[model samples]
Target: MAMAFQSILPTLPCFLPASNLPDGIDAPAVARGFATLGAWSLDDFTSDAMWRDSVALTGTLRTFYSAATVSAGWTERCFARQVHAFQLNPDAARVVRPAPGLGWINIPFTFATNTPTTTCSGFVSLVRGEGGWKIWLLRTILEQFDGYPNVDEPPQQPPVPIDGAEYECVIVGCGQSGLSVAGRLQALGVSYVVVDKVSQVGESWLQRYESMKLHTPRETSHLPFGRTFTDEYPEFLSRQDLARGYQAWAEKYSINILFSTELVSGSWNGDRRRWTLHLRQNGEVRSIACTHVVMAVGAGGHEPVRPHYLGEDIFQGDILHTAQYNNPHQWRGKRAIIIGCANSAHDVAEDMVEAGLASVTMVQRSRTCVIPVEYMPTRAADTITTADRNQYSAPLALNWQLSRLHIRAQIEANPARFDALERAGFRVDRSGDVFAHVHERYGGHYLDVGNCANIVKGLIQIKSTSPNHPIRFTPSGLLFSEGSNDSHLPADVIVFATGFKQNVRDTVRQLFGEDVYDAVDDYWGIDNEGEIRGAFKPSYHGNIWFLSGTSGHSRYFSRFIALLIKAGVEGVEVPVYRGVPGKAHEVEEVGGRGRGRGHKN
Candidate 1:
């Protein structure tokens, strides 16, 4: 059975002892071997390589340097240093004990150069082979602007008293969105605090279904200004690896995060030009103030939907949402019916069958665009989605214009991907590549990662959500409609993979009231500027901003949001780049909460 990672990789002072590691292997020595490569000249490293087969860049490394750059190893800017120091993180080294003789260990490292004063954060994967521990993967992302933080220090020191410390920004939801924003804010030297409803870092990843994985490649999902590689590349990231990385990232920057906390309510005090937030931790509530609020909650996975059903309360069998499902093995030998068809639905269905369930059926409420993971080049998505830290550091209009072109290419490539989905029964209108279809529509498609194969192999059954074949719960099981046909499927479990309601207004109303909620535009859509509707721009409410998107977007755009907040605070003019072609930029006044026409829940 898959278990929650109670103890992470062993650390010098903290991580519990790692299981399955060969005894007496020096970890710091192994770390130095990889650093040698990262500091080497690009030509010598790639021209006559030693042990290239074992090397692969993690998502974090790939985003900064492509495979070619990784092959080159080090950039021209980096060379042999005068005072060399490498710190081996004991608790942060993740062990991959697939087998006794065939296991690999992943270690995260940070090194500093003396002459030029450069610092880098990276991970090295080492395998225990005949020649002792050898380097398998060496990938690092250099921090050019700010030095890596004193990782020994804790960021928030959980349950630590806030004591009415006024912050410049208060970020809610410490998942990818929150952490990514914090990284950017930290790099920009913003006075802020990040708080999550969960007790621990990356509990969002841990609480997912046992088989849940990143549908996207690993390279694009890194936290801003930090290393985000997994133990292996191309392969889906494990919850354990992700959890450990997040913990390490939190430590590296000491990004201020208060876990086991909740922002019960927040209201913008117009008179004081700040937001008063009710923060609840350990059953005690305290009020804190901040000039800006970033709802860093992800675009999805919030406010999950348990679809209304007749007699749902009286259903004898177990009823659950995909968000709450973690153990499919526990439901072994039971008949299960999962409603809604998407990534979660397919993952849950396949997991049930693999866990030795008696039967499983999936009901498709609407067509989903299905794309193969292998369709794009390995890490191709990152090239388009990732904002070049240097490039984006330029003027905002130029950065977005480049972004617009990159996204257009993805949209143009949609026909082929959509054609494949149309051949699989997705409606013509619902077909597009990830950008034009999946991320833009919230989700109208599933990134096939061996999902369609299960349906083809008859391991999982499928049904429709058409009104003609409406699903009705009987005393024993479910009666599903199949066009003009009706069939009874005995189910001991009913799992709803129904997606979340993207109602930012409803969520905002609870804290700031209906007036503030109404001040924002529709939570999501392509605006007149061709940029995303709610992100990186002012929502209808001036002081009120919505910061929710993929991690790559957060890494790239959060800097702009920080600049906006900074401009607003320092009484400087913020050039409003409306993202429209041939239009001159306009300077907007940077104070007061401006209202907009937005939707109500």
Candidate 2:
């Protein structure tokens, strides 16, 4: 039946009229105007119903009435009026002629309409053999409301440059590690320059929250060259105190630090045995050549990450991550929800609770092992003799031997104490395969000995809600999967204390490009039979060395990194681990492959 109807249709003509559009009006303008008005181009108007629909949709008179008044069937009336107005053009009538082997013939024409308030127009005509006609292509001009204006002044030219600049070493990043490296190099009589992207030393620490304080004690966290918080504050230092210490250290040592300078790229000039650093400073790009380059850009330098979730876009209240958490003052009287149960989450929760927030709820994803800071032994209070200092300075062999002896003595003196504490509900776990149930019951006084007692006590309510059960998700946040059950808890704000990725690889790739990875892979030197170093791979060229790439070991990071820098400068093989003298054998056996241990070259 469809084939029979097709045989009865009229045929098209051979020739059709060409377009009358002006030269300045380009193809885009014609298309845009046709698209804006209620008209279809010749290409699109072949289908009668589709052409009618286009005309109805873009008509100006229809738009005016629809915008000015609301009436039933207004859309149908607008479409009808647009079709009638389209039929008024003589050019539109002639172009509807039919052509051979086609459904319609083509006739091109240009016309202008003032009702739409547009400037240009063009159209294609189609002619049918039996006398039916309609437009196939229709277009109108789009005027430019804003024209080009006169320019003011010409651009300036760059000045010529001089040569013959020399530097012994150029260190990038002015954080704790960078300053330590520079100080050690200076003591060794090596000339060096320290540069940081920020405007001041320790500005990175200043960016942290107001309640932020060092997790480790000041005595263990001090830099080399004898500059320490103990010289001033005998306890843990606050964020402000840490910043001041960094500033004073830089001033006291007269460490040459080029502030607000960033190293964009660097290359090893094999011919000159030096590194050529392309640097960006004060909107100007410059180059510096140095014999040695030490990168001390610390961990946690990148931006914080927040995962996408349902209805996140529709969230009506305040939402912020730990990176933006300056203080708890704004949240003092507001309800807050802390997401994730890592160290940062716990610390932030404590801060908010202490600041007198109306209500604070911790949404923990997983159970975490918490170790009290005081559990770790403190440095002896009395001044050490020269012999004791020397003993501390000896190689890993003697250091580890003595440390093992000390650890053994402590263990012997407290043989039944840990067992007794476990029986009394202390909930402590060791670092090996033995998983012993330490505590049968948990009570408020269980955390009395720890400084974070309030935070630990808050866990009691959450723990009582579900004995040995994991919370999967609440009306507010989700919990980590443990054995089988799924659950959720309700809260206000969610904070993820879930730590950062080891970003040295990313930083290296961004600064040096991917080619460096090829060299790193070839020189990694990890024994296949033994465990790999994970992320750290040291590279050296003669006496010059690069010591930036390392993995995600958080505990003892600053100290280990300082020791590595010290070893690089002294031209010695970097030790597998840093420990007390005369205990290397025991330390090597237990510490080398332990959690957080990195393989050495």
The TM-score values for the models, in the order shown, are 0.65, 0.52
Q: Score residue 158 of candidate 1 by CA lDDT.
A: 28
Tens-digit lDDT track of model 1 for 1-601:
0111111111101111123556766666555555454444433222211211100111011111222433433332233233246665655565544323344566766666553354555555565544345444444433432243322122333222345478878888877677766766665555789988887788888988778787777776676654467546345676766777787787776778888989888887666778889999999999888888888776633778765656666678888888778878877998898887678888888888888999888876655555566653344223432334333322222223333344434546666655543444433233234454433456645777886767766777776554534457776677766667788777889898877876565677777887777776566544322234565556546676667766666665664565456545655432231221112153122222343434332
lDDT of 2: 0.42
Worst 10 residues of 2 by lDDT: 434-443
* Worst window of 10 by summed lDDT in candidate 1: 52-61
- In candidate 2 the C-alpha lDDT for residue 539 amounts to 37
Q: How large an RMSD does model 1 have?
A: 15.4
By lDDT, the best candidate is 1
TM-score of 1: 0.65
Global lDDT scores for all candidate models: 0.57, 0.42
Once fitted onto the true fold, the runs of candidate 2 whose alpha carbons sit more than 4 angstroms away are 1-166, 303-310, 380-451, 459-488, 521-601
Candidate 2, 189-307: lDDT as tens digits: 44577778899988978988887776556665555544345567746677788888888877776777889999998876555656788888999988888766666664324456545
